[model samples]
Target: MCTLTCIAISLIIAATIYYLRFVRTKPKLDIPSRDRVVVVSGAAGGFGTAICRDLLSRFNARVIGLDISKEVMEKVYSEELKQYGSERLSFIECNICKLEECEKASERIAQILKEWKTDRVFALVNNAGVSNSPKCTERMGIVEYPEDELLDVFGSNLFGHVRMTRLLYPLMKDGQDGHNGAIINVASVAGLLALGFFGFYTSSKFAMVGFTDSLRREMKSLGKKGLRVTCIEPGFSKTAILNLKPQADTEFGRIGVIREKKSAAILRNAQPPKVIGDAICEQIFSSNNLPHLIIDYWYMRLVYLFLYYTGLDL
Candidate 1:
């Protein structure tokens, strides 16, 4: 009897996977270069820079990168972007947390699209964020949790995405075919698994997942069939966040200590930056066919499956 019950459960689960993976959605398609323009935040970092490089190399699409640190942009690219066919790549110093700066960045990209005679941007990648320390309510003890710090992370990871999408909707919203564009928000495994070490960071990313899910539903309701929403949940790719300053740090010099250490350990076990870069490019080019993707290691994927199906609710 138990064996039969287990078999029945297995069939039900397999059917659900089949429906979600194939039946409910249309077959995936790629976005053509003629209609592609990519706007990526945090382009100064290792993963973001790789993503930009892949986009240019693969799609021949015009790319605009926004970062908080001008030095990061200059140092990270260092004329390498110029080699990817001149003037096709550009970078602006803009903090995602600031709305006015985000608007200015959007305006700059809009102008470029206008010059190219492109009606809308093909993709917007929201990858800017800060790692937060794990300080749950129990860990806080008598000390009050800093709501401002929490809000700061949310501003960059969540609200900034909201503002960017709201600003660029017109460009991505399809006029003729009703197929719009794509929005890719870079989340983390920490968000899904609730990393005990980075409680606040995990919370912010979890919120982002919810935000992206709801946004995707809303877009569908609005009949924007062409618009795609993707949440990038990376399980530690080789990146330089180790040297980057933390958003909540009082002294930028010693920021990301725990994260840097943890990330260094993770680097020993993690995949290369190119793997994630290739995945992001795949997402951009093949989003029409497979809009929702969880790009991670096999073990992570198995754990994700268990959590998702078992309703572990991570």
Candidate 2:
């Protein structure tokens, strides 16, 4: 019994030390110089605005804000442009879900670069995304949801970003001068751990995570060393996504009502959007190459570790 106890304690200590030394250590990034351009989609949203502000204020990088909602985009521009300067900030009202708009936006960005005498796009932040509609209170089961709604979720959450990446890859690929580029995709912890009532959202994010991993491998195979791909999986955050009506009032509430309350309470202490923005900025500036980043508090990390080691699905 004494030997068994000692062995278990040793294993626990080893695991803990490994997690602390490697998993929690932030990598050092090479900061891009000023005068570079970064394209940020979903720029009007909470997290998007934070990323735009950080890039502009910290790196002085020119930012193009892309959004489907002109009103929201204009609002963000009006509030942010003056502080960041009009020359450094611009807005493109484009729906990323549409191929035509993605192509046109790419063209417009290229023209802007030419006019500015810049040669390469420093980074692309694929942040624009949508969750299931608040009105989707129907049975939380997959078959209960409308097919059209599922398509919309997938379009906004996954395919739109794919389209944008394809359209912008040429400018971001390794250039003659050997300037490397970065692509940051904002996924969610739900992408890694499934939630009961969030079937559609979880599925979309899971697909995103898989797609990002595959893209990274492909880039390496093609010798695109300068280009880096990163996927950020953020835990519950204090964003509009959690601002839905109380779960008890919704139709899907019947499925996981208790878990909903618990989740809401936990999310009450969730990290702010700025935390995620800072993580992205770190990735952009860091010289170290990391494929995935989890931006959440320590407690969440512990939970993830437990589930991962136990082979439990959430």
Q: What C-alpha lDDT values do all the predictions have?
A: 0.69, 0.77
User: How much is 248 displaced in model 1, in angstroms?
Assistant: 14
Q: What is the alpha-carbon RMSD of candidate 2 to the true structure?
A: 3.4
TM-score of each: 0.77, 0.88
Worst 10 residues of 2 by lDDT: 244-253
Q: List residue ranges in candidate 2 displaced over 4 A.
A: 1-24, 134-139, 224-226, 245-253
Give candidate 2's whole-model lDDT.
0.77
- Candidate 2 lDDT at 264 equals 64
User: Which candidate ranks first by lDDT, i.e. highest?
Assistant: 2
